[model samples]
Target: MADNLPPPSPSTSTHHDSTTKVTDMDIDSLVHCASYLTLHDISNMVLSCKFLNRVVYSDTIWRRLYREQWPEQEPYIISQTSCASAREAYLGRYTDLQRFKFVDPLVYDVHMGIGAKCSDLMFSNNSILFSQGPVIKILSIDKLLEGKTSIVSLNDHRARITCMRLFPLKETSLFRNKAQRNESVLVTSSSDHSIRLWWKGSCQRCFRGHNGPVTILSDKLLGDGTGKVFASGGEDSTVRLWSMSSGGKRGGQHALKATLYGHEKPLVLMSVVKHKASLLASVSKDSKVRVWDTTISSDRSSCCVGMTCVPGVPVGIKCHDSLLYIAAGSSFVAVDLRTMKTAFKTSTRNQPKLFSFDILPSKFLACTGGVGRAMLWDIRRSTGTGDADPMAELDGHVGPVTHLHMDSYKVVSGGREDPYVSIWDADTGNQTNILRSSSNLNLDGGGCGCCGMAADGFRIVTAAYNGEECVVNFRDFNNAVFYGAFSDNVTGSKFWCPSTSGHDHAGDESDV
Candidate 1:
């Protein structure tokens, strides 16, 4: 009876307050539970106590949130945020990214020095590779930042490099633990009718089979970012298979494994797939296509499994899934290999000739060729209906658009007659900056007729002409901490590298 009457006496009888204080929980428990709070809830929670403030504002909270949102950027961005608080890192990374358009990039010019004409610009890790005629040149990001033009040149190709591709080292982590961290490999095809393999600044193997100048090469990477075999097409109207793997030798042939014949005209472009049945697709100048299966092998030249004709001259060929997507002049076609029938075909009806095709931003197909602008198309549409109107158009080029490239952030397009490359917001079609060559940085800006372009979030690589000769320009951005280190020593520019203080720079005259 006494225990029954004493139940209410804990609050009244004990010398303690009857309040629910957040201090009742330990800091570890509070911090752990902070993950469940919305950012707004956390903000309110911090107002209650200094202890709550520290818990909610923990670095782990911001870092986890950042990683959850932008997992793809972790590898490229982790180094920059190491010392900063996760809150500062998140703010800097996010705010700096949002202001990329407002800021200009520091342009570092590199004259290939071998010749004035170069093409097939590619990026592997932090290095840029391009072909100046037959000379393969590579420049690294670290050296470029030092205002140096250090280049590693390989002159093994006897003639001009017609086409090239890069297989970069595999990015591995807990996410992709099974990936191979193979050394970067460069494959280049030349007018000498040979395809050569380059590894570690030297030519490893020279594959000879094409009868005429090799026009195109497709070396699509597999899961490990390493493909032992590759495909090359040439003026000889044949597609040949070459391998750099150890057991490629047969009858004293080091790399040449098989040859395929199906096109009536010279092969203009080739696209590869890892699909079991349809391994490759090649397009010819005469609007014909030849597809080969995984089992396609021959002592001499093998017969293709099928051939299809695409409308107009083929300008681009890219493979996705089991379908071969070919972009010809004023038309786009996708062939379903399993059914061997046209899946989806779109004709612009001579609108402006689609010149290039690429997969960008959630696998959208973008083309640049019609009317000095880049057009984004919906590649998933399977009807025979023609998409006369592109989803969006990026304009401002004065001449016919010739070169195009993009990454997660921007779409860079150049024209045949325009010296400047227009940088556009990928999500919105707004033109952000018109980047020019720093060749005449002190006086007048020079021409940069972009031949090939590549970009990551931090840098832009262009195989372009600097009015005098072909130069590969490296444009650096997002170095917020390093912006204060401005110097007159070659790589310095106040115009390009703006302050990261979140000020309005929309009206700044970057031309100076």
Candidate 2:
């Protein structure tokens, strides 16, 4: 009792002094607490007092922030360190991403007004080439930056443009001189029963074999972007393979390599898959699906390898690892390539009328159904099951969702009646963003002519009705980082390279 009473009285002066000296706390203690603060809070703290400046600039704090911002890139980002190199690395990465500013809506908007509606679009070498009626318009990305609507118009097709593809040049030609072999070459199909090859905005050759209007065109179908060999399907009930040997030096024109004839009705081209044997898959209005072998030798004519006759029109087709996934009527059927037999079928009784389908890298199928509904089916979980409920159903558009474009993180869908583009989280099926134009559109289906969008991890390009096109910036969408360099190898994007960086220094854009 005596020791306890004496202990407090002896240190009374020291304890009182310590309590009064709170304002003079050491820098380490304050900085460790600041570590829990956000970057903006720390930034304010730096300006609050000279003593806190050092604390805010600590390498440890910045390293934590960097890791928090780009967790997937930690293995590559946090490996290198510096005695005084925290903010420099982070700032460098930030500035390096300035070129990839498409995800930022505040940056800029490109508005172009043409007389006709845009049907399809493709990007190449910072230039946009799209179809409108019987014409194709070419606009440079630089021109868009300057708010210019002046475009190089290519008018040749006699009727409406059906589809177009900008295929890349051969590897040898591309590596030799990319500027010369730029995506200036285009293949277009039209309702005029002609497939024309264009070079530098001029028709180089005309393929005039299809008896009926050519509706679809495919490039790089054989897993090579050479733009040398391509296939076209038309209302003539046939599929034709066309090839331009390297530079087409033989006749300086495309040659008809093979013509596949099997489908009982007019062909509706879906997709081409190259496996042990190259296949050209197309569906018809009569619900007949045909897969033609394009890998036959020159001496042997190409023939139909497999066929599937359904009751309703097949909407779409996708191939992964030799397995064919078809969305027809109210079910998605998986066909084995080896046996050409039905491997499994999953029905969507609750959500019928499957129009278009896309298979995610994770084997999840995202299909657009009746009335602007996009449903996701986990094939691994739903395979061989009958009428399994979808994993998630996303509804946003006011009208029928006609087209869907998806990456690992997001899904961008457009509808027949809605003028807006809805972006959704692919995993959670939650609507993340809705982008619309300022112009008022009055029609049954505005921006419904084309619903698909193209993304380069930064910007999304989409075509709409009334001759309108929207380029949405997706830069900071959900704090997306340039993780394409560090994504998992199983996602089929292991070799994806960032195309929007402005600076590069030994692969580290940061000066530090």
Candidate 3:
């Protein structure tokens, strides 16, 4: 059999002797083999020759090859192969297929009071804040865990409350003559077309300006101490800035610092970059993302950076350092502010309706949509040629996922399903926990509609459609403790809950 076998090919003989010059072998063959190898294997093969490394690391070729094979049925190697023989020959050489694992669920739940639909939920420190109908309720998990019941209801708003934010109180020598830090306050916007400022036990003041419902409120303190201001975006297609002062007096009232007008459609979300307090970004239903310069004089309206526009009806917008991330109809796009251009765009494989997204401090984005799924994207590596694939898909909710919250290592998503809250490991995509609101606690004949996770990554708060709110803490997931609940009294529409922190009430916590 050895004698009958065909003679060794020239390519095979070329590598037999240490002194043999392999330069005469076909370069195309070597290039083809290198393309089929795994990134790890390719690195080893490149050590065999300088030419191999040069070809393998060529940005143009690898980028083109990567774009052609992502999120598809074909293996990257097979996609690069032009001939059936080459594909068949190389398929066996590369056997490592990326695998994803789903882990056991985290167990916890929150009981609802009076069975109502909850629209939004938020978590902070040891407390959870949620809204149902027009009312926002604050629950202290520490108090609940200790079996000491105490729920604070802030329902002073005349109309349905749409969004709530905890503003942080920063001490300034000018404001505090005795150098005492002021107590933090809660800033809330509502469909009633007003913004209310609340302190520990009272609704301090209400600012009226927007003609329509207030959608989002984002505030940041500017400068070290002298001047501090905040911004609020509304469905009225207007963004306003307010100056913080000592009292609720008209003299210290919210100053219409700057009016941002350009969104032809409703503005859905707003985020302020802490490093650049003058820089503010908003996403709107008009399929556009706008960046504004809020530092401009109040007399001069803020202008939008139309040049860096992201196409699509943006449902979510987040900014960190030099990057701007936007979520539109099943896709997310990242733009570099330095270049004022889109760097990468990736599909979420779902529609954009009734979805909410949150980006953790580590550049991980968690998005939930009507598909009843929450997906996490590792955006740090998504640049240059193509977008990064989703690190993991979280599937547990039976209804559309409405809201998502994530920290450095974990994710919490809420939807209208049996399990109201689903938690996951941010890196591994493993299901860390399933927090189910008690069926007996069902409100408005539906499950929790939207939810929020704590900044510390330990608590989840959810709201039902019928006007009910619930909070759950992950620390006691195995025992599945039910923290607390609140009832809404207005339109019976769902309300949003924001995590309760001294900063949330004071507007000092970094925006997500």
Quote each prediction's TM-score: 0.72, 0.67, 0.64
Model 3 lDDT tens row, 1-512: 88999988988775655564556556666566556666567667568778666665544344333434332312233333333333222221121111101111132355555544554555655666766667777777777777665678788777777777765555221234433254356778888888877655567666777768888887455434556666777888887777666454443354555677877776777778656777777777676677777666644443665435555556677778887777776677777776777777776544444366677745555454547677776666555433345777787677777667666556667765544566666666776445444323444455434444443423334443434445333333211111111111111101111122222221111121
Q: lDDT of each model, Cα atoms only?
A: 0.64, 0.61, 0.56
Better of 1 and 3 by lDDT: 1
Ranking by lDDT: 1, 2, 3
Per-residue accuracy of model 2 over 1-512 as CA lDDT, tens digit each: 77666454655646454343423778778768877998789878878867778777777787788779756546555444642376776654543332221222322333445456564766676676777679987767666656554478889899999988876543222234646654446778999998877775677677878899997886444434444467888898788877655343233233677778777677765566645426766777787877777766553334777887654557777776777777777787887867878878888766657766677745465555556677776777766836777777877666666667766766667665566666666666665555552223333444443343455444556654543443322112223333222122111111222233423211121121
lDDT of 2 at 241: 78
**Which pairs clash (backbone N, Cα, C closer than 3 Å) in model 2?**
102-473, 102-474, 103-473, 103-474, 103-475, 447-465
Which of the two, 2 or 3, has more lDDT? 2
> Cα lDDT of model 2 overall?
0.61
Weakest 10 consecutive residues, lDDT, candidate 2? 486-495
lDDT per residue (tens digit) for residues 1-512 in model 1: 77666455565666666686778888888888887766668779879878888887787677666666556445544433434567776665553443244344566776654445767777777788777877888877777778776788899889999988875433211122335455566778899988876666876567788888999887563223333467788999887766545332231156566777667688888777646423677788998887776354453345466678877767777776777777787877778887768887777644657666665525555554566677766555536746656666777665667777765556678754556677765655556566663343221243345666777666677665545566666776654222211111112112222234432332222542
Q: Arrange candidates by TM-score, descending.
A: 1, 2, 3
Most lDDT-accurate candidate: 1
Residue 59 lDDT, candidate 3, scale 0-100: 41
